[model samples]
Target chain A: MSNWQWFHRLGSPRWFYYKTEGWVPWLAAVSGILLVLGTVWGLAFAPPDYQQGNSYRIIYLHVPAAFLALIGYYVMAVAGAVGMIWRMKMAFVVMKSAAPIGAALTFLSLVTGAIWGKPTWGTWWEWDARITSMLILLFLYLGIMALQAAFQSRDAADKASALLALIGTVNIPIIYKSVDWWHTLHQPATLKLTSAPTIHSSMLYPLLTMILAFYIFYALVLILYTRAEILRREGRTQWVIDLVKEEAKKP
Target chain B: MHPVRRQRLFFILFIVFFSSVAVGLMAFALRDNINLFYPPSMIVAGEVPLDRRIRAGGCVRPGSVSRDRETLETTFLLTDGIVDFRVHYTGILPDLFAEGEAAVVNGELRADGGFYATQVLAKHDEKYMPPEVAETMAAVSDGHDESCEVVQYGS
Candidate 1:
């Protein structure tokens, strides 16, 4: 199929839903396996830091959760952008589905960061640049969710939230660069794409693995969430009715 | 291109412009509220206002950490290698806090030129858990080893 042909096909909720169904179980299995493996390797095999002791193990969860939180905002914003431009239903579905997971991951990152902070930073919370920007990110996610719900029509909700997502995209850079921009209690980045990582290979490998696991986990969870959204939005359609009947007949 | 398509292009541009404006406003608002902390050099230069709560950080000068046995109060010299100042805390320091380590102290700057610290953070680096003990906690319960040992450190 041509690239644009596939794009048109994705506009149909039923087509997107059916297409994604076969992909979810496999994604779930892979994510679950990788998450368990990465966590165990990080918490067990990865040597502790020379300084922080056992408390640094929270990195296995915190880094990945924080990574996905920023990434999810982009995913949501791009999807919103596409949906607005081409009016693709699947794109909007992807945007809507991304909100809760983004919020949840952002919340996880903040909580884990706080927990990790107590022993290292000496305070449960600091109004440091990174910390404050992350708080705004959480607010953006929550704001999108609240906006999506407040509108009476799905179309209105999609457009309003999409606008908000685009606005929030600006914050991700500020959050990522907060340490560099401000002299706060937070340290400079441990990992950099352009240069060598500050961490050892033994530890860095598990953290990288965790990052992969979290991204896959996001895709798997987003697919499931989108499928539910598809069913909800298309409940009156024949395809959904037939799907329900088929499932009923099977069991 | 059709006028309709041109209008759509204009709409996308409008969204971008709108977002930038909003972010710019937030950044402008954040500037004054966020610049509450100053480095040790700035503090020593008398840049920070006295009698107000302020934050400062530097290396915990080696051999400068002293504790009172009865009061459990600890005092350490905070230095940025150029300018140095003293920080006094009446509570336990962070686990990662040590001499020659980067630390941030927040408290009131007293009339006596000393910082009476209310909080002390290791600040710069996060010390990690031990990796030498590769096995799970089960290995410890099985009495394989008492605790994880430190290997050669790079940093």
Candidate 2:
């Protein structure tokens, strides 16, 4: 089909819902498998850093979580924008589904970074640029979630939250560039498309694999959450009622 | 304004206040990156230039630690495999620091490569020792004392 037609279909809640239903289980399975394999490869097989030795292994978890935290915010912001601009119900569903997950990933990044920092930088915390910006990102995610829950009307809440998300996007660039803009003890980017990786092949391979695995996991979870949101939002629809009844009939 | 718009305005104001404070702190701490990492061996070799912010790292020499009579300062020797350099700091040490432990000091190098430290970091925890230290100990201890106690210190 044409690109516009494909996008048009995606913009429809019913079409998006049915399409995702079939994909979620497979995506979840693949995500789980890749995550397990990648973690083992990173934790055990990867050679230790020449300087840091085994403690550097924490980067596998730290970097991936940080990457996902930033990416999740973008996902939320873009979804919010789409919902506001096009008045698409599915877009709202996506925005709502993304916030808590993004918050969780951001929290993971902060905690893992703190743990890794203790061994390498000698302190459990620093008010460094990247670290500080990431903390703000977490608060932004929390704010969106809280605003949505505080409102009585779902539509009004979604619109308000989306606007907040769009505004909060200013911090995303700040987070990405904080290492350069300010003096941070946190090392610069290890993986860059234009330059060679700073690490050895043995270590870099597993890190890349784990990053890919993280993206797949995000997609899998997003789909699952979106499906749940669909069920909750469309619970009054005949199809949803029928599905619920059919499931009830099952042994 | 609509209730949604009013709510958004409040959120925006809140974010603005926090972001400005974060940015202000970051700008104040800005410094050169290369100046931030130095091993004691590098310092002894006069590799770090004087009066520039740099980090010096090495194992804390077993018996070279002494406290300053006045001020929050302390003096100790940091040693890598081949060389040792004196480090002086006037701030709080990280919680994990102790004799024979690995550490990294951030500050400036003197003209003579003696490090005048602004910040100090103990390298690892009891559960997570730096590999460099473990390897050094392993090499030195070869078939000797295999029962050396792992070090831990409370902040």
Candidate 3:
């Protein structure tokens, strides 16, 4: 029971806020460093792909954005599930905060993919299974965000968006399997969980680093957004008011 | 867990499970139309309808490319290692378009079985390596074809 205490404590807005307060700058610095290192290494050091040449370097951004866009959806769905099941206000806030970030990343993935496609595939867009499925993912994120904004009551908004988020989880597996399940213009995954990566070590290492950087960056933004939401939602509470007063009193 | 909380968790699980099943059935039902292109084998079997716009994708058979030079008229053979067909296009090809590479062509099927392509797109494989590594690989496996083996057609 004691071991699970942290889980219950995490449901508290004040506890979550103070716990993540000091982590923002640290995460920002680490993610920033990794992003710069990975980008530079991928761009300059990694050899040009034998077939595609330098255009392949965009994988550093495209793959990471696509990876996190899919992952962020699951994170949002799980948080929504927790809120719906346990009535955790913090979980609801976290779920609400994840929508725009996931949407932006999905947009980034699609744009980078288009830019990469023009030179490689000879088309800026295709109705291929993989590309269509990824576009659907962006729409799913946008739908959840729109649902959250549509309701008049906060509780109603939370429940409605949570249900939609849960239902949208169906698309995640579909997006992942679209390339394999159907003939697609897009190539199959370069990195596989079960097998060694198809890419050479020079290209794979920086890509792996960029993926890690994106995950940390996602966490950092999620925490920052959730903290702000907590403050807004809990503004009338004595704890939040006192914390604000304390901050105001400081030089 | 509290009884109400346990019930809510189960309810959420039920919703997710049923929705996924519904989506899965729809995907299975529409599987054929979902594929971006048909393999040369399917077209060779006469399964694909004629006089309609459709896509066929396969590896560009090595030594099968011939160009008109003056015009953009170019012809090459596409194969799935099981069946081979020719694709004719009259436009600039992508940079990666080459012999032994995967390509998808969209247009109509000719009476002679060749594809008259309005659009031609190159499809690369999952493998990525530097030119030096590729040269070494070519040297190590002279006369052995490894490119076409990586591409699989949708069944």
Number of the top lDDT candidate: 3
Off by over 4 Å in 1: B1-6, B25-32, B126-155
Question: Which number leads on DockQ?
Answer: 3
Off by over 4 Å in 3: B141-147, B150-155
Please write out the lDDT profile of model 2 over residues B89-123, one tens digit for every residue. 88767655777767767788877657888888765
* Candidate 2 residue lDDT tens string, A84-114: 6566788889998899999999999999989
Measured against the native two-chain assembly using Cα atoms, what DockQ does each of the candidate structures obtain, in the order listed?
0.34, 0.11, 0.84
lDDT against true structure, model 3: 0.91
TM-score of chain A as modeled in candidate 2: 0.96
lDDT of 3 by residue, A1-251 (tens): 99989999998899999989999999999999999999999999999998889999999999999999999999999999999998988999999999999999999999999999999999999899899989998998899889888988999999999999999999998988888889999988888888888898878999999999999999999999998999999999999989999999999
- Per-residue lDDT of candidate 1, residues B1-155 (tens digit): 45774676578778777887887787778774665367777778887789888888777776789999999999988776667788889998887787766778889887777899998887645323344532353365321111111111122
Which is the winner by lDDT between candidate 2 and candidate 3?
3
- Residues A1-251 of candidate 1 have per-residue lDDT tens digits of 48668778878888888888899889989999999999999988887765666788898899899999999999999899888777777888899999999999999999999998988778889988889889999999999999988999989999998888887788988888877777767776777778777676778899999999999999999989999998998899999999999999985
Error of 2 at B56 (Å): 12
Give the CAPRI class of candidate 1. acceptable
- lDDT ranking, best first: 3, 1, 2
Total clashing pairs in model 2: 3
The runs of at least 3 residues in candidate 2 whose Cα sits more than 4 Å from the true structure, single-residue gaps closed, are: A1-3, B1-87, B90-119, B122-155
